[model samples]
Target: MDVVNLNQFCIIFPCYVMMILTILWIWRIVNWVWIRPLQVEKSLRAQGFNGNPYRLLHGDSRDMAAMIRDAQSRPIHLSQRNILPRVLPLHHHIIANYGKASFIWIGPEARVLIMDPLLIQEILNKNNVFKKPTPNPLAKYLVCGLSGYEDLKWAKHRKIINPAFYLEKLKNMVGDMSTSCSAMAKKWEDLFEGRMVIEIDVQPYLWELSCEIISKTAFGSRNEEGKKILKLQGEQAELTRQVLQSVYVPGWRYVPTRRNRRLKEINSQVCTLLRSIINQRQKAIELGHVKGDDLLGILLKSNEKEIEEDESNCGMSIDEVIEECKTFYFSGQESTSNLLSWTMFLLSVNKEWQDRAREEVFRVFGNDPLHFDGLNRLKTLTMIIYEVLRLYPPGVIFNRIIYEDTKLGHMTLPAGVHLLLPIILLHYDRELWGDDAHDFKPERFSQGIAKATNNQLAYFPFSWGPRTCIGNNFSLLEVKVTLATILRRFSFQLSASYTHAPAYVVTLQPQFGVQLMLTRL
Candidate 1:
């Protein structure tokens, strides 16, 4: 009788525990999807601001996704460069309905759109107050490096990495940039041999060109194995695109799903490859065989010098250094490729500006070797680059988080609220940019950025304040070399097969790919 009773007690206990666990899970979902977001929305609405009411579970994700789907379904004419409709459907819709200063729900967080230039500048300037929000765990696997780091760690990384992007250092990379761009161009020229004009989608080649430039500059090697490292890095970037589309749920990365497993595998592979390179370089340095002069070389050298001064003050670990290499590779490759693609598209449609740029390139480097000073002399090229950035910024949405309660503009934002400064909205504002905001006019930047937005904090394609893009100068120099080299050899126009669709992947890019008709000059 005693044994039978004991068995019954055990069975009943197990059943009760299962019931209780199920109840708890239901409660969690309710609180997370409904209760918490409703509370935040109430707090925001009480602050005298306006926006769409919070929706269950997905916030505005469903609506935003649907809107994007509908927008991208059609193709706009190439001459219509205003991509605000497709790239930023939700933001554009909200701004139109709820006014400029408004709010929206991205998951449980309230993303307030702060549009005032002064207010935006203040937020960007006060990094301590408006800290970068915690990134998704899976995102860390993609590319976090210096951008995601905060405060002290960020400072250390920036200090060590600064010399790599110094104007003098970047100038040393001009030959590499020219060579990489020309390699792709030569391929295109060969394809067009004995032909007057040939149509080709330019994105694929430009993507290769950007990757090759980084590989040449980053590793300073023409060897076979370094090419594999670059090839893997490029593949990793491609894989991350679909993963980026998902809203990050905590611990979802631990599920060992196919995508998650693949991402982890790729990340591990990249780190391993980078470590091999690092070890080889360290061995060479110890033997006094070479001075590290490439970006990776400079960073390692800088770190070594710091550690030598004080043993306690060590440099980055092998893991950290690998992350940095991935950072440079991803940022340099992604952003510059987009910049070049858009610049060429604009130049293709706006032949007047194309002529102006070609004329300037000829005047500055006409039959002479392209030099560092000559890049500075291409003022017309500078204007075009600035204009392209304004119209088509690679980073469309910049965000900040308030870790504690903070006062912004006319209201006090509660702790944990996220602030969004949409660059596309600001760039296309009529009040800031005058009546021709949507038009393709590089002249706005002719007298320079200060005169462009009437000296307001209105332009920040690379970003603003202390945390602006570290690779901006490096990227610009590459653009100068690639553009100057390509313009010297060929003239291009938009191919009839081309569809004008600017998309927001990890960065803004041509959705259907950029097709151009090339005429070998």
Candidate 2:
């Protein structure tokens, strides 16, 4: 009788534990989906922010998607200059209806859009308080190196990566950049094939050129292997973009969805390739067969020095190195390619600027082999690049998350709230930039960036403040070289088939490829 009673007691205890665990899980879901959002919405409303009311777990996601689809369906005419409506449809609609100081729901989180330059300056400056939001788990699989890290980790990585983008190092890479650009020019020449002028879409070629330049600069001798890695990263960027568009469901990444599976496969393939490249590099270094001059070489050297000095064993592991390499591939390729494509398109439409830039390139280089020193003399070309960046900045919006209740300007932002800085909107603000804000006038930057906006924090193509992009100089140098090389060989104009639709996919890009008529000089 005693044995039977004990067995029943044990069975009852197990059942009770399961019941309690299930209840706690249900409560957590309820709080996350309903209760917490309501609390945040109330707090925001009391703070004088207005936006679409929160609606269950979806929030404003459904509305945002519908607006984007509608905007994408209609392409603006080439003559139209303001792409704010099309590029950021949802944000445009919210700001128009709810005013500039508005909050929008990103799933359960409330994202407050801050367009005031002063506030943007504050947010960007206080890196400790306003932190980079945690990336979506699915998106993280693609690339998350220095850009994704925070605090000491970010500082450590940035320190290690800084040497690679030093002015001298970037100057060294100009030759590689010019080589890739010249190869692209050769391709265009071949396509002309005795024709004085040939119609071609320069977008894909620009992409390839950017990839090749990054491959050669980042990996040196193993550029062929680097090219394959970059190609895989390109695919990964597209896949990651898709994942970012929707509201991320918790634990949904573990589900064996088609997109998830493909992302995993790509991640695995990229890692394997990177490992092979890194291992080969290590072996070459051991054998003293290679000079550590490329980006990877510089990084490895820096990491070794850091470990030797620190004694904390804080040097980056192989996996961290791989992640940084992925970042170098993605950011290095994306920023320059988009800048060149947009610059070409803008030049194609504005023929006078195109002619002026060509003239500057000729005066500076003068049929000489393009060199690093000549890049600075192309003042007209520099102005043009800056204007293109202002008009169609590669990164449309920058986001930061508040982990603790923080004071931002006059408002006290609550924890768990996200802050958004809409760069496109600021770039087109008539109040700040005057009546010709929407115009493609490159001369605005004639006296330089400080004089352009009266030394305000209004213009930040590569971001601003302490945490500005480390690769800004690297990207600008590459763009200058590529554009100078192309301008020396060919004069271009927009083709009749060209469409003026700028789409945001990780970076701002031509939705329909940039078609142009290139004439050999």
Candidate 3:
């Protein structure tokens, strides 16, 4: 109890504390890189799966990054088997080496392939059983909506947002989409005035068109603001994609790094603009100047109804709604633009199909404005679109995480294992499709999606089941209208400068740009 004895005890206690802390840190690393992964590897091996053995700290991350860098460093040549290797270097390597049902580690967490049609269906169907994992911080900040929610929150959001993308609602917005396309076509016409045909890279134009269409259709009067968001989001998504592709280190965002600070600033800038747009929309709703028809109006109206119906089942916060708006702008614009770009590229390659599609479009509406009725009648055009989607899907893969021990097919998966459903692989699978699965065959889907894969869950460019892309109908209508409008005004073919490289950023886009030579019809 003496002071001198107390001082001695304090000095010794500090050293003991430091020793214990260091031991705990080392044990955590041991568990991550060795003990825990070994246990997971054992479980997967029992299920007849094989893959690269885990390495300390990085696991397969360094290998994946190196592969990606190597892939990017090469020339983007066309006509050979493309996309799969470039988009998902690690996955392609694992599948090629260890077979389809192989596992690879992203840090310590194992991602095992589930390539069977029925098993993939089961995983997607049970939304709650297989939860979506938290994406990189930049991804979450840039785009999160129903993709990020679970349980009650997901149910409520899905219910309210359902009407926004219904066939009926999407039909009403077809004009906005078509009108935007027409403007673009007119601009093209002007640009190629004296020339019989003009060669232009159409990706940037399609990107702008889609952005304008989504902004006008969703936010109505606030498209000017939406344009600002569109510019910022494009940059942010590129940055996020880079971050996700790298070997992710936890707490990297917290450090005062240059990229981190830039991302934070972009986030703040976007949030501020979005808030202004939202407030303006809210004021308009209060004034009864607009119906809850536009996406923003509809979402707010739907959320308000939920709150009125039950206070405990609260609607989304303003910030959550802002996030949803970001999701709408980015995904809606990205997918449709990619779809249109790829379809144009395909049509340019297959001039006979282009002639047939144009013939159909001309027969449906003889120099008239492209409308929903005319679009419905263009079955050939629809067939071409479906075929392009099969060959070049916007999303190469879809992932889900297991939060609890669950049975996928015949075996039980532990909570930490992630399910990897490579949709592009299935789309190109000869077993599901035909000998010409790798070839462009629109006739395959002339019989409709069900008959195309013999009632299989093989084609899901927009995904499938309960959590299907809510903007599916919207995107389709927009794409149909845009393609029809362009086809009517111009007869196009692949330009000599055109290169066929399907790149996978957030979406599968033409890496070298879709260059087409168009003549006024």
Best lDDT among the predictions, by candidate number: 2
lDDT of 2 by residue, 108-214 (tens): 88999998889999999999889999999999987899999999999999999999988899888887888788888998999987889999988988988888888
lDDT of each: 0.84, 0.89, 0.84
Clashing pairs in 2: none
The true-structure Cα RMSD of candidate 2 reads 1.6
Backbone clash count, each prediction separately: 0, 0, 0
- How does model 3 score by TM-score? 0.95
Model 1 per-residue lDDT tens digits across residues 69-182 = 788787677556567888888899988898987898776678999889999999989887888887777767768888988998888888888988888898889888877777
Per-prediction TM-score to the true structure, in the order listed = 0.92, 0.97, 0.95
- Residue 2 alpha-carbon offset, candidate 2, angstroms: 6.5
- Looking at candidate 3, what is the lDDT of residue 458? 87
> What's the candidate order when arranged by decreasing TM-score?
2, 3, 1
Model 3 regions lying over 4 Å from their true place? 1-22
206-290 in candidate 3: lDDT tens per residue? 9989888988889885667777888888788777877776656667778887877778888899999989889988998899977
